[model samples]
Target: MSNVLRIALVDPNDSTREMLKAMLLGMDTVWLEADCSRYEFFSDIIEQTAPDVGVVTLDSDEDRAIALVERLSKEAKDTVILAASESTDGHLILRTIRSGAREFLTLPVTKDDLAAALGRVSQQKFGTADGGGRSCEVIAIAGATGGVGTTSASVNLGCILASDSRNSVALLDLDLALGDADVFLDAIPDYTLADVVQNISRLDIQLLKQSLTKHSSGLYLLPRPVELHDTASITDESLRKVIGLLKASFSHLIIDLSKTYSPVDMAAIEAASRVILMTQLDLPCLRNVVRLMMSFEEIEGLQSKVEIVVNRAGLESGQISLKKAKETLGREVYALLPNDYRTMVEVRNNGVPLITQAPKAAITQAMRDLAAKLQGKSGGKVEAEPDKSAESKWKKFWPGAAKS
Candidate 1:
């Protein structure tokens, strides 16, 4: 048996279908199942190969696409089917999902959308990025409370990976208007995320990549719009499509989600392979994290994927210890990043990652440790010790998660 996640591509256009297959195969770790267009051929290969995921082109005719989804669902209940079409109607997209498509996209197929869809499929099958074999990791950075340094963590982490000379990382600022990722990177993109979201139906990997600004470190950044109101109403559906595209193109995909929760942010959260909830050691931050932890625990398949990160951990002491915070929130603080004033200002002034500015700083070292963990390194000294008493508290707080 092949050791890769088998993906079946179904599109009639020879170029489009082959291009999709080739792009996926370029990953060198994915197994391409039989490519077919005709309904009969598709059914045959699907039964014979038993692909992990399905990619079917949505016909101009809704009835035809709906019928295809229905038939595929009956044949492979466990398999996820992703649909693609040439239109970007909200009603049509919703209708397809309701009909049984796990995901939807518009063509000429941007690499970003394709990647996001594949990432979703990978997550659904394997649970986490680390659980899967040879797939990109989707890490989302969000704040438990506003201004907890989620954006900075994401930006610096992305920069570190991009500059490591080992992997390709793409940084996405999903904050829409208030996003400072571009400003921090000192990049003023001529094209904002508005171009991709508004023109998603016509998106392709080439155009999507072209829309981004490449840093000297080889990091690709997708910045939000300069005017927040322009994209405040952006839908989760649109965000998923774009993120999916990025996943297909980059090995390490980092998302800087908006501080406040919205449809766009929720979509990113759901699609995240792992969510880093940033917080500080303060009463309000702890309280908010406790509440947010409850919500994460309540949501299916979200609890185990969330990683609590305490930024500027040593900045304030005694307001709350890591033990008390974990006890209150019912989760472990996966990483503790210190505050270094000089490094902070340097990053702010230069619009680059702290690792690039002061790689030896206390804060940068903490980030490097976190990144190493993400890359599956082990035996490194942990900065914070696990609180034993907090274990019972967490179990009581989230019985289901504890039981699982």
Candidate 2:
């Protein structure tokens, strides 16, 4: 409870422990009072040292670590319990929090993450908010196929969200090979996802935030790597680790995903609170939407989180009707993005956001409504579905489709 806070830690891996120690040495307000390798012996060290904070690394043995946390929460009431792990899966974080950990840190232990955790303990024990981060809402935008305006929706929605002075939004261009989110905003970033993954050991919230390209609308952009080879090492776990850190700092994370539905996209989808499936009222897009929905049905709880959005709804005379599109998707379209070829093409070529270039355009209003829907506000009404008995080529095309 003094100016310098006392700390004790338990991590079995010598390398990871040393890395953590080096990180802690750089933090000026913290003092390493004692350290232990064994989970059972950690309690005794805390009892003897009387440290203000106790750090427990859970990757070595999760069961024992949770048990130790529960025990310390009751026995050593004065010390704040903090948990760490290489995995950011919700199950571990939830269980650790339930066992009475004050803050959960992801491993290799970013310095800012540690400082924020300890700062939270300081605030709770004495009233301060030095490094605490407000919680963030993550939204994943996926395309049914190419040219469906997935990136366009993502960038515009992000810009609209950032228009509010009270909000801070970050856009992640996960389209590794063909991403244009950076070009969309006309902001070139110094670093990309690959740089973050390669330098993960040295990354902290402060450093990572500084590396991103901040747009004039106050939106932070993390674009895809410049070279295709740079994306090879960006795996699901690494992407999750980066996302976990970003979630700690931003208010909103808009992930513009690659259309491949690879492991990387699955990881982002798994982490998102809202998933927008961008589709147009065309035969190919609709079929792909249903196919994707079938895949989602297999993934336990994924289907419920998705919202089917129809882009370029009134683009052409031959396109499918909104009523029939609903019957084809077997679900109501979340929102309709009107087709404004001149406005959109100009905005894209000029590298300006629709929200900025064409503020009064109908598509811009559609972006606002999309943001409102994500925020649980009243959105534009969806058209009601027509009769299932109506002879439909889509129903006949794909057997065992959803009931109309």
Candidate 3:
């Protein structure tokens, strides 16, 4: 029950078994059911456990592995056979296929690739997003530009979502070097994101529950690595694996991403069910929005999920008008948050959420409305009406999202 995948594996070479074990352990969904070095014992183990998936490393002994795969395919018809080898030879892959292996992995298996391959098995079996029974919503919050209140939106929105007693929410600060999500909640953590990835082999739902810092609002937090040096170990693959695991466990996964257009950010964005692009009414922020939209256009299916929200609206009379901003961007603005600098400053300093600290403030109400909208509820005051075409129509996109 702790993990979705109950995996039985066989590796003829004992030298590579430990490496394979570490990679599989790091995956959030994988549970090592039984690992054996002898091919003769693998089928017996698979029959006894009837694991969800069976993995066979072929490089150590291709003929033996293929024979095992063929035997297991018949003997354990319920379990799917997954083959991996350091060799990328087409003939070898064909042999695995002919022998009844359902999937093949080019070896030197990365944690990400390993996780993804196993995930496919789970998906093929369950017909859900992952092996985990639940399909949680992943919300990635990005700034139109730095200092435009993206992080603030992420923090408050997460708190609002977690306020519902039925919802299990996890807030991830993915800014790496300068993330302050933990500070925003006023919780000091004994563990950080780096700790999870570094010790991935031991990661499970129970262990994850123990590692995350829980707030009074019932929101769980996994802040960015405390030391800047720890950020280096957080690869794009590791991040995706962590995010996938969180998605399985929580009802809502809120990610606060950095302004850097790094692979790490893109990985999170790709995993998200919705991307909240936070902007202010300013020339600089608008310009960045244009750039980001154009960039989003290049990626498949990325532009459609983006929901543009104007943060700190009405901060200055001189700022851009919502109408003009929509005309400039080619998409309707989704929501607008009022300017409440003093309230926000107080909330952040006290390490409390806006809803809890300044519940009656206008901005707090706006935040609640925004949360309601995201939660599939009505009563959101700020919207450009229901426009289904807004997401896909790129013609005349603000300054045109086309980079050419």
User: lDDT ranking from best to worst?
Assistant: 3, 2, 1
Q: Number of clashes in every candidate structure?
A: 15, 0, 2
Ten residues in a row with the worst lDDT in model 1?
Answer: 126-135
> Quick one: ranking by TM-score, best first?
3, 2, 1
Write out the backbone clash pairs for model 2.
Answer: none
| C-alpha RMSD (angstroms) for model 3 | 8.9
lDDT of 1 by residue, 3-98 (tens): 235678788767777778778766644555567866546766677667778888876446776787878888798677888888899988888888
Taking the tens digit of each residue's C-alpha lDDT, what string does model 3 give over 151-181?
A: 7889899899899987899999999999999
Judged by lDDT, which candidate is best? Answer: 3
Query: Residue by residue across 1-404, what tens digits does model 2's lDDT show?
Result: 12445688899878888888888757755656667788989988888777778989999999999999999999999999989999999999999999999889988777877888888787776566552233467899999999999988988999988888767889999999989999888887899989998987666555777878999988899999999999998999999878876775577999999989999999999999788999988888888987887688778788878888889878777798988777666667878899888888888888899878989999899889889878767744455553446435445556665364
Return the TM-score for each candidate structure: 0.65, 0.67, 0.68
**Weakest lDDT window of 10 consecutive positions for candidate 2:** 126-135
